[model samples]
Target: MATLPVEYLRTTRLFREKIGDVEIISFEVPVHKYFSRNEIPYLATALDVDFRKMENLITDMKYGRVAVEKLWAYRMDADIIRENKKVLLPDLASNPVDGEVDEFEDAKVLKIHVGPLKEYVRVFVRPRQGFREVVVYRKPPHPAFVRYVAYL
Candidate 1:
């Protein structure tokens, strides 16, 4: 885990999206920061996905050309952490914990049917620790409590 810069904590914008009973909150970190030695403390490993392919998948979903499925499981894959990094975005990436929704106790799973490719990242959203909410957004879900929810 990387320690976020104090400035990022203060200046980074946290975006919130509400999907049904879910509230998805997220923020973007400048991708360039990944290379900065000074910002290393605040960075987590970026998702190494085929950016163009994933982008196309997202576009297809937006146009109703692709199928999306919601799967509920007790655990989520560690790779899910990468989705929150927003590595597909041009300038920004996601912090792993940004999607954990630590504010809620109930965690639900959202599985986007990106074929059966084991290499693709899986994203999910659950309520914050105390409230009942689910999050859906342009970005992916954050796996905040990964140790507890991590899939073997």
Candidate 2:
């Protein structure tokens, strides 16, 4: 429910491994921003971890690959508005006039589809005020996409 400004976006390429016929790679995208100490505790509590240890947990990343496993985003409860602060309504002129807007509560979380590789990767920013955690998940690639990426 808190609004934290985004300050940094980073990507760390982790090790790559092949298991049988499958390949797995890991990456960490950290987002750094500013937030109050009170907000930090709430985030820690939500993740069911010690608040006091967050600094080292994020900085040193003691949990290794496991640390990136619990990645998630909270669905926001507000409506998107325009820069003028107007409640800009949906475009009824368009076809398929479904009233509902596909509002993604967590804008920071990104799902990337690498078409050539036929692979999907999930990215999210962990709101730590001064720092946010970015995690990506790579799913198995489709046969066509695999061949496409290989050619690139």
Candidate 3:
């Protein structure tokens, strides 16, 4: 329906002139990515990735993660995770249950699953419509973390 904001369009155009758009935009693992600094080690262990080597990759911030509007358009499936020996806190096990109205107020609950090992994640688009974020209920073993080592 609506394209990006005017300011974004302007800055993004300037950014394009400065540096061309890329198929994948990447950045080092944010030091403050998790709520607390203490949670990094455990997350590294669970994802089977080095804490220092982790990173966040989005298709492109300007056009968003994908050509599609939906935020969850790009995903790493269980098979991919398992093959890489990258662990998922909330695996198919843990008796994960979808979220109800109370958990995520106002915003549409895309997917929220909870388990005993604090294994679950709630990936949802905010009520503001264009906002997007990933929420991991458990911090120590971040449920929505993965390490992607690729030549591309």
Q: Rate the local accuracy (lDDT) of all candidates.
A: 0.28, 0.30, 0.29
Top-TM-score structure, candidate number:
3
Rank candidates, TM-score, best first. 3, 2, 1
A best-first ranking of the candidates according to their lDDT comes to: 2, 3, 1
Query: Candidate 2: misplaced stretches above 4 Å?
Result: 1-107, 116-119, 141-152
- Of 1 and 2, which scores higher on TM-score? 2
Report residue 112 deviation for candidate 2 (angstroms). Answer: 1.4
lDDT of 1: 0.28
Cα lDDT of model 1 by residue, 48-84, tens digit: 2244443343334444443211122112223544533
TM-score, every prediction? 0.21, 0.24, 0.25
lDDT for model 3, please: 0.29
Q: How much is 55 displaced in model 1, in angstroms? A: 31
Judged by lDDT relative to the true structure, which candidate is superior, 1 or 2? Answer: 2
lDDT of 3 by residue, 89-117 (tens): 33222233444333456543333344332
